[model samples]
Target: MNRLYHESEDWVAQGSCRQYDPELFFPVSTTGPGLHDAELAKAICRGCAVRRECLQWALRAGEPHGVWGGTTPEDRRYMRRDLPLPAAS
Candidate 1:
């Protein structure tokens, strides 16, 4: 198995986005035409089998840009606000 797969990121290989351009998930903006791009990405994510895993990963990693798991950066930021901060080490 690939190192990435061994690390448990294998679900990425099953994502519907694989059939499309990666740029579709990294729109330049979040308004106007970018909104359309985001919607397109979300459409792809909606049918993905690993969407929940993708979203969880993005949230945990504090991903700062692009679309993930059918959600835009702004969407994730809002969602993060509702989550408790990590405990101190």
Candidate 2:
């Protein structure tokens, strides 16, 4: 997998959630608490300029946790199922 960190356009470094608790994005709550936390994290993503790239990075890395790119782990799983498989080398 390629790393976007070294690129000049990487916006994740400037994410607003950077100052918040990491656990906020990895909420263990499956009820109202979790939902609320997820929303908070997503609120940050909604205004992020690098939201798409952050999401793609998480998907490619098979990130198993967190509300990355404004999506929950389950959301990313659904997305993964819809992605086209890479061609064999």
Candidate 3:
């Protein structure tokens, strides 16, 4: 885990989707209502104060699932490629 994550646990409590089902953010499919659910998850993230930090954590952690910082996994993958992170300490 990174220092930011260790220091940012409180931010997760402030996330808009905290009360929603975790599965909603991690849909099993990308088709049909699943896509809509992802958008809904993003909507919640947009309202979160720690959206940027959440995204950074997800990218650095190489999260393979779920929505974070209003972005999908595919979004993070592209980001990781375009904005390579430094090796973990």
Candidate 4:
């Protein structure tokens, strides 16, 4: 069964995640201002209602790539360093 936090029947109302696609959201590293797309993804979490749940899902799923809760790989690494890591079993 799907684990972590799956969208409830009503979560689509937030209208944020609909634009998020793991493959497409990879961190575009360039010499620019602000967080990379990777970081911007994580930064968005600041105001996100499901930030905690999103972080949990990313850590538990062992998602090696993509952004979650507006956080990128490095951001997630720092945040989840002490969390129970779920192997990508």
lDDT by residue (tens digit), candidate 3, 1-89: 12234455756666767678778888775456678888788788888888998888788889888888887887788787896633322
- List runs of model 4 lying over 4 Å from the truth: 1-15, 20-24, 30-35, 83-89
For candidate 4, what's the RMSD?
A: 8.1
Question: Top lDDT: which candidate number?
Answer: 1
What are the TM-scores, per candidate, against the unseen true structure? 0.81, 0.73, 0.75, 0.52
Model 1: residue 21 alpha-carbon error in angstroms: 0.5
The CA lDDT of each predicted structure is 0.77, 0.72, 0.73, 0.54
lDDT of 2: 0.72
lDDT of 1 at 25: 86
Ranking by TM-score: 1, 3, 2, 4
Candidates 1 and 4 compared: the better one by TM-score is: 1
Report the lDDT tens digits of candidate 4 across residue range 1-89: 11224455343345355555543355554125423554555555566776666667677767766666555665567666766433321
Clashing pairs in 3: none
Give the Å shift of residue 22 in candidate 4: 6.2
lDDT of 2 by residue, 1-89 (tens): 12244235366577656778878877885356687888788788788777888888788889887887887887788788996533322
Query: Who wins the TM-score comparison?
Result: 1
